[model samples]
Target: MKAMLPESVRATGADILLGNTYHLMLRPTAERIARLGGLHGFMNWDRPILTDSGGFQVMSLADLRKLTEEGVSFKSHIDGSKHMLSPERSMEIQRLLGSDIVMCFDECPALPAERAQIAESMRLSMRWAQRSRDAFGDRPGHALFGIQQGGLEQDLRAESAEALRGIGFDGYAIGGLAVGEGQEAMFGCLDYAPDQLPSDKPRYLMGVGKPDDIVGAVKRGVDMMDCVLPSRSGRTGQAWTRRGPVAIKNARHADDPRPLDETCTCPACTGYSRAYLHHVFRAGEMISGMLLTWHNLHYFQELMSGMRAAIASGTFEAWEAEFHAQRALGDIERV
Candidate 1:
């Protein structure tokens, strides 16, 4: 996977990639990765890499995570080993990984919780953000981003944004959304969230969504976003395009000889047919994942590029109109 990523990203024109702190720590540990020359060398990808603080995984992936004033204590899902992740420790881990962009350690409360509960969690995350800033100290050319958490409350989001601004950071991330909040509610929060952060710094929407979600967020002034949908869906026989998602594993594609997307230049779409892709996926061939993943990433990057160009040319509204128009046409009829 690592060997193919660099080439795939290059083809997609992606400038950065995100690495999961929790998963990497569970496998190789931060110290071990540092001894082996950090994640850049380990992954063999020299491009900029952003590492999350593992706080989210501590809440979601760990077996019995206990949150406290300092941090969270939990057991590894992989080996059942106990571990603790504090703001300082999270900073240290990202540093050891030699990440270009490091995220602040912030607690994320699941949605549908009481507003009071979310407020308390947001306050705790703010305190941890200060600690993370102190521990990160000075790292030339490296960035530390503060995550704004407030569940769905606008006032609390403003408060969190103010706290992050007071602590100062190279960038700001809108966290705690997309945890189950549907796109409508997420967009409602985003309508005001991005404006709360400093206009000079980049605003990132964390764990954001599908093609439409990205377009909506970008329209709201979010400068960055990260999601596993493209790659994950690709591995599951899904393909995203201008017209919508294509379920390549369906029987309708069994005898289809067309490419996944005629407009896509990726290998899966340009060098192979839908029938061939369907056969490989049904056979559980590893190449199916590789090809589909490549295509998905390529399409996402193309979408991003189109958005960027549209924004620069001051034609984003028209571009978005056309985007929706195309999707309204739906996927091509099954051959």
Candidate 2:
């Protein structure tokens, strides 16, 4: 919704929205949003909204951030204002934002770290998870989710999951992956991580990825995922389609009159041609981003719908085979 209209996002069949607690809290202030009737009212989005607990942003984006047993203290990137985000504070912020699904405040360490570091971070996050749960208290409608943060260590992951389960939550998120971890490493972890959590509750893979990554995560038992790739790529003149990723700014599209994808029914494909898209992108028109973003989100939702149907019908193996085969064909042969 930040890059495009909520109506446009809804048109793409996105049932839920993810809001950044760090951004909203720092800029607009969570208190201000509460007066404006929370994020759903402020953003005019009535659907489910999941708000991360601001742990990742503070750890990665904040200037001169310091991590401690209590919480993280840092200067905001926006104004360099001093702030602290403990588990209790994170819970309070999410409540003020009126988030339907809230993630526990948990530390996510960078990958390629020593096992000891990973273990230490995971233990700290587990403690924070319990604190987050306690602070969240009894919100009747809002659901708090516990985040698992064990980096890539299987034993640590199991331990983290066990901790979260003991504390209890509405859902479980597999965090600490996708933080500089390559697909192979991530996939290796996913092979067992999802299973470690309870099968009854929702299993979310946070900050997950492209089309193939989504497919792989789903196949490995992930129930939900969220990413900025589609919208981000859209703004950068890229589009994701059934065939594969398409660079819309390429000169090859200067004269071609084909749609980004012949099979796509998005506004970008059905109503505009590659030449037009390329022209708008090169011309630096704002509609360029909107069109591509709409197309990418549409394609992603379609892919998920396809997978859901295939899974229901017990034909996922065949569906997966065909999905790869389609991408292998690449974009249409030279316009």
Candidate 3:
């Protein structure tokens, strides 16, 4: 797991780490990880880690699972073996993994769904939230987060938020968004969604987005968010830079001698030329993914750092304007 992001590299920029409960629960298994001292020990990451409830897998891997009020019955994608993931089971798995932040098990209905369908899914999730709470019990250093799932319905969002508040959790997550909902719609929901939750608690927007999406969510009061875009794109030879995404495999970069981004301080940018990165990726070298992934991660960290500074200085708007303006300029032309 740390092959792409070693703790040493990730820690230098990341404030925290996120783990996939679904995958870990399936492979290596939660019991094995627990015996080995949990995810932090197994992964060699000392920083805080947040693990999802396996609810996303219920939605994403719908074809491989059956949904019911009790829980999801999944046929292992790896070996076709059967496994059940209920609220109680999810809580137990997170506990075994020793996650600092655990998410409540909740069904995430895909977007463009009927309001009736969304309502049904949300209510079920609320029920599971209670079960998750009871199963988690009281753990001193651990925190359980309740997820609000109502699709794009304002009233349902409010209802879901209130239900979570009634249950009371260490934190709250705005789930069921960014699941094929356009950015405009996601932002529309966030505009009122975060306000619906406890102001003092952290508001996590689940499975969110590109650079612009991150900025927009932060602007709308989303306390935190998660996405796989940076690393995923990096693996495909794309680089997320201040100026926008750079396709490192492009022929133009094959002979270019410039840094991916002149201003970038990442090792890939500082220590290698565009030509070298281009060559490795084209040659199918493993380091191609490693270097670009590190660069992309570094750029994302820098983006957040800039936003935090701008927010503190009351210059967020100015910083945002510059961000868009720089991206609009596009990748530097051969000059």
* Model 1 lDDT at residue 220: 93
| Prediction 2 TM-score vs. true | 0.98
TM-score list, all predictions: 0.98, 0.98, 0.98
Worst 10 residues of 3 by lDDT: 1-10
Cα lDDT of candidate 3 equals: 0.91
Q: What tens digits encode model 2's per-residue C-alpha lDDT throughout 114-164?
A: 999999999999999999999999999889999988888999999999999
lDDT of every model, 2 decimals: 0.91, 0.93, 0.91
In candidate 3, what are the lDDT values of residues 11-117, reduced to their tens digit?
44886888999999989999999999999999888889999998898668878998999999989889999999999999999999999999999999989899999
Best by lDDT: 2
Clashes of 2: 0
Q: Give the number of the best model, judged by TM-score.
A: 2
Global lDDT for candidate 2? Answer: 0.93
TM-score, prediction 1: 0.98
Better by lDDT, candidate 3 or 2: 2
**Which 10 consecutive positions of candidate 2 have the poorest summed lDDT?**
55-64
Clashes per candidate, residues 3 or more apart or on different chains: 0, 0, 0
